[model samples]
Target: MNILIVFNHPYEGSFCNSLLNSVQNGLKMASHSIDLIHLDKEEFNPVMSAQDLKAFRDRKPVDSQVISYQQRLEKADHLIFIFPIWWELMPALMKGFIDRVIFPGLAYDYANKSNTRMKPLLKRIKGVTVITTMNTPGFIYRWFFGNAIQRALIRGTFWKLGYKNRKWISYNRVKMVNQSKREEWLVKLEKQFSKF
Candidate 1:
């Protein structure tokens, strides 16, 4: 299987960073091809300019880098998103990355006259996992945000894009966690990756 791991955390020593490494190592150990993209280190712009939108709609052209990312999504069998949950939502850069790169023609197509239905372009992908960390408890996130980013990515996007077998693992209350708990989470993540 080919896995594309998208890491959104900017900090080098964050727990998200560790989780990214764990997932990568586990997947590689499982004999899966890995394409890990650190969003903060990438040179691609995250802006969706009006001209770029026009070009996308016209099916003319777009930034080659964005096009390449789209192609990776098209080819990968699994897509993993790693980030820290802030304000009960995804970071601005991560959201912008999605807005700019996963454009209409690339990720979806609205061919029907009513525009009520969309054709998913990433049907080749079969699985998705969102790895997130938050300072608040998991229950709080489920109560306040109702797992906002999870639903948005897993249901609003990937499932709609024909990705079957969606899963999410969130490490919560990291600020109050002890070393033991942290290691436990790491072991759990290692096991999760092993299953892939």
Candidate 2:
């Protein structure tokens, strides 16, 4: 299986980075080809500019970087996103990637030129898996904050685009956890993806 991993974190020593490593190792063990998009290393521009907005309005991407991402998306049979939750939501880079690359004519389009209807263009993708790490407790983020990440990533994006088989794995209160606990989570994550 061809997999595209979109990852981002400012610190190399962060738990999110370690989780990314575990995921890659497991995928390698399964003999799946991997293409990684490390947003921080690439210095991805998160702000959408006027030209970008124009291209978006035209239903075509003119930005070179977004175009490159679209090319990678075309080859991915499965999509995996690994990032940390900041401010109770996905970081700016991940959100920008979606705003720029996963636009109309790339991820979806108007169905029969209807304003309210959409047709997904990513037929090659079978499923989406998101792995997120955060300091906030799970219950608070879910019950109190209303799970903004899932609502945005799943319901607002992929699910609405007509893609099914969505899965989300979140590690909450990671900073407060002990080293042993973190290591156990990594081991479990690796074993899970080894069968993917």
Candidate 3:
């Protein structure tokens, strides 16, 4: 299987980075091909400029970078997103990557000129896993906020695009966890990715 990891975090020493490493190691152990999109290191432009919007509306290509990212998406059988949740949502970099790369003619198509519905274009994507870290307690994020990231990415986006096998694993209270607990989380993540 080809797995593409979209990692969004600024600090290299952060827990999110560790999780990214664990995922890569696990996938490697399983002998799956791996690719990474490190948003910060890549200096991805989070802003969708006027020209980008115009080109999207015109059904024309945006730019080489976005095109390259879309091509990666096309080749991947599975996608894993690693990021820290802020304000109960994805970071701007990941969100912008979605907005820019998963544009019309790539991720979906209007059912017809009437545009009453959409048909998914990403037929190659078979599975999606989102791994997130949050400072908020798990109960609060799950019950109070209703897992906003899951709803946004899994239900709103991927489900709408016709992908059904989706999973969300979140590590909450990350700042309060001890080293042992963090290590345990990494072990668990490795096991999970091995199965993927």
Candidate 4:
């Protein structure tokens, strides 16, 4: 499988980076081709400019960066997103990537003239996985906030684009976990991704 990993942590030595490494190693073990997009390292612009909104409304391309990202998305059979959950949401960089790359006429389109529903365009993508770390407990994040990331990415984005096999792996209380526990999580991630 051609797997595209979109990573969005700012710090290089962070646990999210470790998680990204583990995911890459596992996918490599399975002999899957990997394409990585390190958003912070790439210095991606997260803000939507007036020109971007205009292009979107006009059904035109946003920019070269977004076009390149979309081309990567088009070639990948599986997609993975690794990031830290901040304030119960994705980082601004990752959100902006979604807004800009997953544009209309690319990710989805109107079913008919009635526009009753959307038809997904990226049907070649077989699976989508999200790995997130947070300081809050998993139960609270799920029950209280209703797993906002899952809803946004899986339902709002991938599912709307006709993807059904979506998985979410969240490491809660990351700041409180010990190094040994973090290693164990990495091993678990390796095992989980080997099956993919």
Best by lDDT: 2
Candidate 2 per-residue C-alpha lDDT over 112-135 given as tens digits, one digit per residue, 9 for 90 to 100: 755687778989999999999999
Could you tell me how far off, in angstroms, the CA of residue 23 lies in candidate 1 after the best superposition? 0.5
> Sort by lDDT, best first: what order?
2, 3, 4, 1
Model 1 ranges off by over 4 Å: none
Off by over 4 Å in 3: none
State how far residue 82 of model 1 sits from its true place (Å).
Answer: 0.5
Residue 80, model 2, lDDT: 96
Compute the lDDT of residue 177 as modeled in candidate 3: 88
Ten residues in a row with the worst lDDT in model 1? 59-68
- List the RMSD of every prediction in angstroms: 1.7, 0.9, 1.2, 1.3
User: Residue 10 lDDT in model 2?
Assistant: 86
- Per-residue CA lDDT of model 4 for 110-133, tens digit only, reads 888896678777777888899999
Clashing pairs in 4: none
Residue 137 lDDT in candidate 1: 89
With a 3 Å backbone cut-off (N, CA, C), the pairs that clash in candidate 1 are none
Q: Candidate 1 or 3, higher lDDT?
A: 3
The lDDT of each candidate is 0.80, 0.92, 0.90, 0.89
- Model 3: per-residue Cα lDDT over 1-196, one tens digit each: 9898999999999999999999998999899999999999999998999999998898676688898998998999999999999999999999998888888888789887997677778788888899999999999998999979878998888877777799889999999989999999999989877876
Which regions of candidate 4 fall more than 4 Å away from where they truly are? 114-116
Ranking by TM-score: 2, 3, 4, 1
